[model samples]
Target chain A: MEQRLGLEASIAIAEVVCRCDVDIVAAYPITPQTHVVEHLSELVADGELDAAFVPVESEHSAMSVCCGTAAVGARTFTSTAAQGLALMHEILFIASALRLPIVMAVANRSLSGPISIWNDHSDVMTERDVGWVQIFAENAQEAADLTIWSFRLAEDRRVSLPVMVNFDGFILTHTIEPMLMPDKEMVQAFLPPWEPLLKLDVDEPISMGPVGIPDIYTETKQVQQHLLTQAYGPIVETLNEFAQHFKRTYKPIETYRSDDAEVLLCTMGALSETAMEVVDRRRKQGQKVGLVRIRLWRPFPFEDLYRAVGNVPVLGVMDRAISFGGPVGPVASEIKAAFYHREQRPKIVEFIAGLGGRDVPLSDFGRMFDSLYTTGETGKIPAPTIIGLRE
Target chain B: MATQSAKPKWTELAVGTAITVPGSARQNRTGDWRSSRPIWNHEECIRCGVCVIFCPEGCIHFDQDQPGYPSADLEYCKGCGICAHECPTACITTQEEEE
Candidate 1:
């Protein structure tokens, strides 16, 4: 009834999008993400998928083209990684602000200064406030699932917001894995043809992206924020609907072995799965350590995260990106802020790991759990540990 | 006059409430910024419709009820006078707005 293939995650994700029957795709390729657009172009050329593959000169034009195509009520898709996603920064906010419902796959990569192209969360972390619903994938199958579901969640009339699906560069994007490929009829039954809420039809004209004057600017922004916050309900609903049709379960937060565990390690992107392995190994050694894999990064899933870490005294938040001299890393800082008004908040320890595409071994995760337990026992948060640093 | 317009609360406004109506910007009274206004003369005008083509704001249209006549919607025409300049018959002229 289904096809299982040893396909690279990028190709697999692109195949899922092709099945979604997108109307237009415009993308500029960057390392570890190029295979996705390359395959999509092949599909379009071969007439396997009836869609327009616009060849843009740069990532800015890529996103701008997506905006133009989406404004016309066309189902649009694009993929980029690292610097390319950064280059689309100006239009990224505009895409969400205009509510274009464009879906993108960002192969998570480290940023420059030293000019390295590799896996990390620095790119997406730098864009945390870009107003798009962001989600991370921990493995090849998850990458395939989320890329398909991004279109569903984004185009939902209730949400009508752009979505960014982040999968780790090389770690997940380049790996070949056996993915459960949903057939065409199955996808069609799962996702209906997108009915646009608003469009650029000449017969029924409407203005879009007109200047927001001082009188209405604040209210416009308030409504946009409200929509993003309200979108969480529909996001969960669509995921449930997706599971019913495809039979693969997904949650905002995926927890592993946190039941009655004293200390919890939390992570995002591909390293989350590795952290779970370490948690199991540490548990065998008589340590009460477990993990919380944060799948939903934006619309921050505060309630689900808090529930997953329920009654755990301490949390080691592993952030692949740094905030540069801030008291804690980005994910760690957000966790603390989420706990600020809670009745019983766990003591959060910032663990900055895997910057600039450096290897983050299971040993580092184990060490982080050890430090978290010690700090909780001593009742003192350690001065933000930079794990696996040469220092 | 500005205060007469209704301000929508964020909760009341639906998601994606963009200003989408074509030509709706004319309602904002941008014509109030006019330094000059164009006067149209019917006598020397050839009905070539050249002025309609050159209008910068695209606010010019011919009224079918008034034949040989191009008219401007005074509410939106910024009075830039490109229509007057492009008039072959020199039937239109720009006059300064009175304070």
Candidate 2:
């Protein structure tokens, strides 16, 4: 029987990875993400997880080792955040382009300029175009559940793309919460062993990363893009599969009371949980309000987003990441493109908030809704408001 | 105009006849590692021992004579070709096999 246990998101993530029985874990310790890898290292040390743990020198080498191990038909994993992830950006693109199903945990943190150890979406925003399936977790429970789903979605022969599960640093990463831990046998039934299509073998003598001539270079990229674009159906299928075993169902975009609502609040990552209470409080006050939680950001679930907020007069997008000199936040920008051709579209307002670990209180979200409802009537996209900034 | 000519620099183009590699160089295999099959032009000889000293893996050795020239031990060489690049007379050629 399964039991509910209060666990830090970092440790919970490690538990599911251990249950998946990964063949290789190449990792380097870094802030916020450190506890996850540390627990994994302990698991390897104690013989609970029988895998090759390569204690690498840097995040670059860590991902490089992951690329090498995954190329040879081994299930590989790693974790990092902030500068550690920025260091691995070059290798991150290669991991997906080569179609290696390497699963990684990103303890979301602020990118350094003023040098913050706090949580933010800057690191993930910089890597938004890197061809990996990115998911944001709303709590410790989601973090644990998403890790199991990540492997299933990634290793599906149809997908074969890397997956990144982002949990907010300090807020969810260090916070303990009660989560249902599924049994190993259940997870075994959920995620099967990875069987690679093309791997380096002595008998076959196949090549990886070969220098193709100009004649075939475009075709290679076209095939990679086609395979990833076709992955949407399988991604949804696997998520529904996981939800069938577990109680909670996660989608690309989750709707909370979105039906017949006038205004919809959009958010990603752990902050969505905080936004939910704000939606709940105002709903009791007779405000036709709802929330749209974006769990997957890279594929940018266009159809689901359009359907969730259908015919709402005002749609407010809450961004933890900034695109500087752009109107829409990362999520909002993608949503706007989905409605470009539609004759009737909701007035989409963008709110850049909670950067560098600012606390987004209930009052801040209240102010955002009021501002959008008033200014949104004129139909011109209002200047985005930054909530909880250090002005 | 001469600097921007269509002709490539001599250093950029390989001059010697091509050699062939038999197996993968990227993996740490268990068996005897493949080596570069080196050819020596006896006429272009000064007997400088640069190739033997420059080998990082130390798979190169001297001939059995008073004037000892360099030869590679194929059983141990991983085909990195440090010996071919360091040859003073430019007599040795190396080739990496296509996949």
lDDT of 1 at A85: 90
Query: lDDT, candidate 1, residue B94?
Result: 91
Q: What is the TM-score of each candidate against the true structure?
A: 0.87, 0.80
Model 1, range A1-391, lDDT digits (tens) per residue? 4698898889998899999999999999899799999999999999999999999999999999999899999999999988999999999988998889999999999988788788888899989998999999999999999988999999999999999999999998888988899888877777899988988788887666766667677887887788889999999999999888788989999998999889998989889888888988988999878889899988999999989999888988988888886755898889999999999988888888988778889888878988988988899988888898776
Which residue pairs show backbone clashes in model 2? none
lDDT of 1 by residue, B1-99 (tens): 112145766665434566554565546877878888887888887778898888988778888337658888777789899989989989999989896
Residue A320 lDDT in candidate 2: 84
Q: Using DockQ, give the best candidate's number.
A: 1
Best by TM-score: 1
DockQ of each candidate's interface versus the true one?
0.33, 0.04
The backbone clash count of each candidate, in order, is 5, 0
Clashes (candidate 2)? 0
Candidate 1 achieves a global lDDT of 0.87
